[model samples]
Target: MLDDATKAKWYRIVFDLKKQFGKKPDMNGLIFLIGVRELGQMREFAKHEKMDLMHIATCKLLSYEGYYKFEHIDEEGWPHYSLVQKPPFTDLMSQENRLRKLIVDYYEDNGLFEDMDQA
Candidate 1:
């Protein structure tokens, strides 16, 4: 399980992403930022940490939004990334602002921020 400090950092990243771009993020984008790992590997990591995949995905998306860079090896021995200079929060917002809004709305509807507020 992630420590409280880490969780707080993750939440801050998520909130900042929303504030900066006014949007939520895609799962694939999040997975890529988390390390470009395969789905099965991600699942395993989540299981090991006793966290849900959705939660992990959310945290990773936020991390990416907060400009946490990831490095992965491509076939050409070069690096690949979910974000290059910075996380593509603005680009994602442009591509699917409405969808992003809907996602944040759904999270609010589901009380995703209740715990944060309590803290």
Candidate 2:
């Protein structure tokens, strides 16, 4: 289970994103949005392309923990990463929490929570 503070921050992020995008997004949606941002492109993605975007976002997030590292952006504009080490989180719950914490950290690092913190 998520602790109170973490849950609160997560909700704050959700609330902020809803206001910005005009709808609430689940965790996967947040990942997709992050992928869109990291890709540095603003266009509709195909179904498979959407999957690739989520992969890109996952790699970028895991890169924060030394599990992966950015290699280069491809000619097609997709960013690639290489595995530096094995991830420690194995089970589903642990993986979920890991991603959640990373998402929270990402939002906080990008200053997305500044106004939300005061509200």
Candidate 3:
């Protein structure tokens, strides 16, 4: 469980990223952004490809929890993950909490918060 200070810090980080991007990104949007960054291919995506990107992000996040496993990147440069176990959350709030933890874990793991002074 996250302590109060840690939760506040995450909220601040999310808010700051929202400000930086000049929009209030919802959970899905944040995941998409994270997915795009993970994709490492800065280019336009097709309208139908957004869901695929989000799936990629979801897989990436869930992998840390042992629900997925990272496989090799394909020739197209997209990363693939295989299911290792079922997702840990079921209900709406629980799912949201899990995603929040995943987001914070992503930043922390990648040192994305090391220079987060603006928040």
lDDT of 1 by residue, 75-98 (tens): 633333354344345565453543
For candidate 2, the per-residue lDDT at 36 reads 95
Clashes of each: 0, 0, 0
Question: Which residue runs of candidate 1 sit more than 4 Å off their true CA positions?
Answer: 31-119
Query: Poorest 10 consecutive residues of model 1 by lDDT?
Result: 31-40
Worst 10-residue lDDT window for candidate 3 reads 110-119
For every candidate in turn, the CA RMSD to the true structure comes to: 14.5, 2.5, 1.9
Query: Quick one: best TM-score, which candidate?
Result: 3
TM-score of each: 0.28, 0.83, 0.90
Candidate 2 wrongly placed segments (more than 4 Å): 1-4, 115-119
User: Among these predicted structures, which one has the highest lDDT?
Assistant: 2
